[model samples]
Target: MRTTIGYTAESIGYVVGAQGLVSFASQTFFGTEWGWLHNVVDLPSTAYLGIVAVGLALIVGGVKMRKTPQPQKAA
Candidate 1:
């Protein structure tokens, strides 16, 4: 269960990070033209980088959780 949750978090993090990057790029380079995803859910300009940061944190945490050893069960 722990590993499963960790894997799920990692997957979600990748998606969030990718979305943030695209959104940030669009807004930064295209002069207020945000990514298509922004149309679905708009956020403040500051939140774009914040999203990327959160996504990276989640990825790191998930990787740590997935790598941790589980306790051995008694036979």
Candidate 2:
């Protein structure tokens, strides 16, 4: 159960991290060109939320891993 939760959290982190990277790149490279899309919706807040989500997911995954017991290795 813990392992499953850990994996899910890690996956969410990866998704959020990817979103942040993409938003940063687009904003840096395109500048006002991307503003058109922003005008259609709240891009800035969305980007911020994505970053925060990534951080939270990472924290959850780390906590789960630290608290869960490791399986024994075969000799």
Candidate 3:
């Protein structure tokens, strides 16, 4: 469960980061002619902080998954 949640968080982080990049590219490179994604997928100051928090949680979850032992299967 923990590992699954960690992976999920990582996926979300990638999506968020990608959205930010797309927004930047659309507004800066593409002359603000972006798609709906930029409108819905945005990371402002506080949201960026949330992104950082998600990253930290991912790292912590990875470490915990590595340090913790796995359960054995029954015969």
Stretches of candidate 3 exceeding 4 Å from the true structure = 41-75
Residue lDDT tens for model 3, 1-75: 766766676666666555555555666565663444545655443454454455566656666665577787899
Q: What is the TM-score of each candidate against the true structure?
A: 0.82, 0.53, 0.51
* Cα misplacement distance, residue 63 of candidate 3 (Å): 7.8
As for model 1, its CA RMSD to the true structure in angstroms is 1.8
On lDDT, the stronger of 2 and 3 is 2
lDDT of 3: 0.57
Model 3 residue 28 CA deviation in Å: 0.9
Whole-model lDDT per candidate: 0.83, 0.62, 0.57
Model 1 TM-score, 2 decimals: 0.82
Q: Write the per-residue lDDT of candidate 1 for residues 1-75, one digit (tens) a residue.
A: 889989999988888887888888877777565556698778766678888988898899899989999999999
Winning model by lDDT: 1
Off by over 4 Å in 2: 32-67, 70-75
Worst 10 residues of 2 by lDDT: 32-41
lDDT of 2 by residue, 1-75 (tens): 677777767776766656555565677666633323344455664564567566666867756775789888799
